[model samples]
Target: MNYSIGDFSAITGISIYTLRYYEKESLIIPARKENGRRSYAESDIAWIQFIKRLKDTGMPIREIQKYAKLRAQGVTTMADRMEMLARHRAVLKEEIGKLEEHLSNLDDKITYYRTEIRKCTNLREDRRTAEVSCCT
Candidate 1:
């Protein structure tokens, strides 16, 4: 079924302006009515959802647009699409490595603070014991 721009916007959670912008950016191409109204298909809705996911993953508009273009061109571009996915995977790997390094640093800091706290608590306990003996 074909959906009007408003229906597309409501169902896809993309604003009408953004839907237009996506068309302008070549990220999406909805069918146009004779009067120039945009008619989106269910497939277009799915594509928009995928685009949103790619954006959330930090894919740039240009790259996403390119991917969308390649996708629309069909299975002949499979190798190129694979290359794109490989590039994205590399970026994700680097990001994961950075996060792991940050986590390690945080863990070390936590260990250091915990050790200091234990020492301080032990010292306080020693002081309390000495005072009790002296009072006796």
Candidate 2:
């Protein structure tokens, strides 16, 4: 189905300005009508969703534009596209490893807090006040 630019923006969750910007950057090339109005098709929706995913993955605009250019070149650039995606995947894996390490550290801190809380409760039962090493 053909949709006007406004309709395209609404469906894609991108602002009209951003849609135009993408067009200007050659990241997206929407179909134009006789009156010089931009229109989008179902394929454009799929393309935009893929573009959004790539952007979400921290792909730079220039890289995305490069990918888009390759994509527009047809099946011959499949290898190059695969290479780019593989690079991004490696970066994502490293990021995930860092996140996991941070999460583990947080879990360790939580466990320490639980133990400290129990000790404080026990000390409070024995006396009016408990000295926490953290405060000293």
Candidate 3:
């Protein structure tokens, strides 16, 4: 089934302007209606989702454009596309490793601060009780 540009944008969560920009970048090519409006095929939605995932992965525009070009080239380019994806995966793994290290560091700092606060709570209670001294 085909969808209007507006429907496509709602379904894909991509702005109409971004969709047009994708077309300009040759990342997607939606069919045109007789009146020159866009008619997005169901496959176009899937393609858009894939593009979104690539963008989320921090893939550069030129790299995604290369992947899109490879996709347009049909099954014969499968190996080439796989190579590109493999390289991207390696980089992503490295990035994830660094992120995990940072997360661990943050968690350690939070634990240290929490312990310090707990230790200070007793001091605070002692100061409050000692000041009043409650002499009857």
Query: Against the unseen true structure, what C-alpha lDDT does each candidate score?
Result: 0.88, 0.90, 0.91
lDDT of 3 by residue, 5-87 (tens): 89999999999999999999999998999999999999998999999898999999899999999999999999999999999
Report the candidate with higher TM-score, 1 versus 2.
2
- Where does model 1 exceed 4 Å of error? 115-136
lDDT preference between candidates 1 and 2, better one: 2
Winner by lDDT: 3
TM-score per model over all chains = 0.77, 0.89, 0.91
Error of 2 at 104 (Å): 1.0
Name the lDDT of candidate 3.
0.91
Candidate 1: tens digits of C-alpha lDDT, residues 58-83: 89999998899899899999999989
Q: Taking the tens digit of each residue's C-alpha lDDT, what string does model 2 give over 1-136? A: 9999989999989889988988999999988899999989999998998888998989999999999999999999999999999998999999999999999999999998899888777777677665645432
Candidate 2 structure lDDT = 0.90
Report the Cα lDDT for residue 64, model 1: 96
